[model samples]
Target: MTTQPERLQHLLDRLLRGVLLPEEAEQLAGAVRDLERRADVSDAVAKGNLRHVKQLIPAVRAAEARVHELEAEVSRLTAGQCTHSLAICETHHAKPVPGCPYPRCVAARATGRAATA
Candidate 1:
């Protein structure tokens, strides 16, 4: 579910970095739609329009936080830090908190292979 947005963002980020083409601008609509849905859902529960109030209320808050995080990640990648070390890359591994970048085992495996090679 969350994978689609992350994949699209990565592809779009690359395309923009390469040429900033209008073709790449084509994704704006879908992005806008996604954000709109997120916002609408959030507002519905927040303003007391939606049912299942107790369960939905928390879900809405979480969605809002996700929007903020995605916005920041877009900002960061747009600012030309996309090529930074994965160790420091935001959202690299999807750890609930920040700074997970990637798993330690992947690095360990790579190092193990390199040492044997």
Candidate 2:
């Protein structure tokens, strides 16, 4: 016979797959809250053995830290590229820089008159 947790897990799985009955939806929520309380684990993670879950915490933290670092790097690179493009746009004085890849810059260059000294 399946245990309550197992049945609750099955219900939760069905709920996640969009197949649960209306009553089962309520049941799934209650089961999830109760199990989460009992396990003292994050709701973000639905299911795992205790040992594995414990092991994953640090790994998850590390991966999240790495994600933050990469996000910062991406932001910095994008800002730098935008600044470079803007500078080039200003230098060319509304014209596209000869080798600049921005289509708007190219359009501006095509339409813009030469800058007066």
Candidate 3:
């Protein structure tokens, strides 16, 4: 027997190939509803986790503050370094540099225009 996910994939493949029959359409709808239900449950669980984290934050306030300070120090130390490499052109307001291997940069260089923010 096919799992819900497998059935969903099959239904999607059939949908992409042609119109679904009435029963197939109903099946697809059911699959979509099931997926939505799962997503809702996941969202609720995430929200519960977030609430738990928030409750614990006060207990770890000192540690959290130290972490923030360390993060700031690291940022200051790396300020002069190019962390993103050619992905951002420092001279061009963080736009991709011309001749950059990234597709957007290649397209920009081809058009003789700097990428806009």
Candidate 4:
């Protein structure tokens, strides 16, 4: 059996190896990990507007995943992107956008147009 520190070390190693660590294994889970947190997002996603919501989901997931991947890479260059529960990104756009940084995500709001970039 691995000690907690050993397990944590293994988890970090896996992060370096481009593997996703399980939620149970993370030393700390981020805000995105919280289930009860009511997100403040755009009306399109919250109103269940399909046109704008579809494109945004993957982009958001890719960005968030990329951030974690980068953090793992900075400390260890051997790691790559891992799916794990993060793959549940497939289930997201699950939250609405309180604010969009993307021009398309923003344009979709400004004119009520399907903003795809």
Candidate 5:
């Protein structure tokens, strides 16, 4: 049987050490449940589009994944030449034009042309 002051001191020490009694833990859990019950995320959960809300994390993640794929495809296609002046030859000429910027131009120029450049 502890004195009243000793019990209070022990309780304070336990609290300072981050220890909670069963009743304290139960009360805290109940308070948290109440807060969650009253919390207002219906707009996010109901809208379902994740627009203009904190629930857009999954949507943003999906968009970022798509962007990564597109970026990878662009990198593979251009090999970092997407920014340069590359064009496909629509003329269907017998030989590629000299100094053309297309990747296949050199091969096309060499195949059927006798030009040495």
Candidate 6:
């Protein structure tokens, strides 16, 4: 059996040639109405999706702002603390903490070249 699009094309071609039978004309009209109904449903679905996204925007923005605030609080709390790993200070640039076992931390303390926060 031919697909709906193919059937529609055939009917359209017959109509254009001015040789479409009454039944074929009815089929063409039905296909056009079905296409219009599908378009209307799709438009309604899209509008609904847009409304949902609009409703979510303020909540999303508020959550993002809270995340930024928490990050800032973490930064404030961690200020003046060593940011390097306990095992190694790769850059040897982190602030030295007393009794740290890492050689870089010891060397930085000895040389007084450790970075200050």
- Against the hidden reference, what TM-scores do the models get? 0.30, 0.34, 0.50, 0.24, 0.25, 0.67
- State the TM-score for model 1: 0.30
Global lDDT of each model? 0.56, 0.65, 0.68, 0.49, 0.57, 0.74
lDDT of 4 at 82: 14
Clashes of 3: 0
What order do candidates take by TM-score, descending?
A: 6, 3, 2, 1, 5, 4
Question: TM-score: which is higher, 3 or 5?
Answer: 3
- lDDT comparison, 2 vs 5, better candidate: 2
Residues 34-71 of candidate 2: C-alpha lDDT, one tens digit per residue:
87786765643454566688899999999999999996
Question: Per-residue lDDT tens digits of candidate 5, residues 1-117?
Answer: 977457556666666789978885665566556657756466556666545565777898999999999866653444334224443343333345555556455666668652222
Error of 4 at 37 (Å): 34
TM-score of 4: 0.24
- Please list all clashing residue pairs in model 3, or write none if there are none: none
- lDDT: worst 10-residue window of model 3: 87-96
Distance from true position, residue 105, model 1, in Å?
Answer: 64
Predicted structure 3, TM vs. truth: 0.50
Model number with the top lDDT: 6
Task: Write candidate 3's Cα lDDT for 1-117 as tens digits.
Answer: 999789888889989989777799899998899889999999999999999999998879988999989966654433323345543433433443423455555566577665443
For candidate 6, report its TM-score: 0.67
State the displacement of the C-alpha of residue 102, model 2, in Å, after optimal TM-score superposition. 15
- Model 1: per-residue Cα lDDT over 1-117, one tens digit each: 648778678757777688645665567556777889999989977777545676688998999999999977864553243245544333343322222223442343445432112
Better of 2 and 6 by lDDT: 6
Deviation of model 6 at 60, angstroms: 0.7
Best model per TM-score: 6
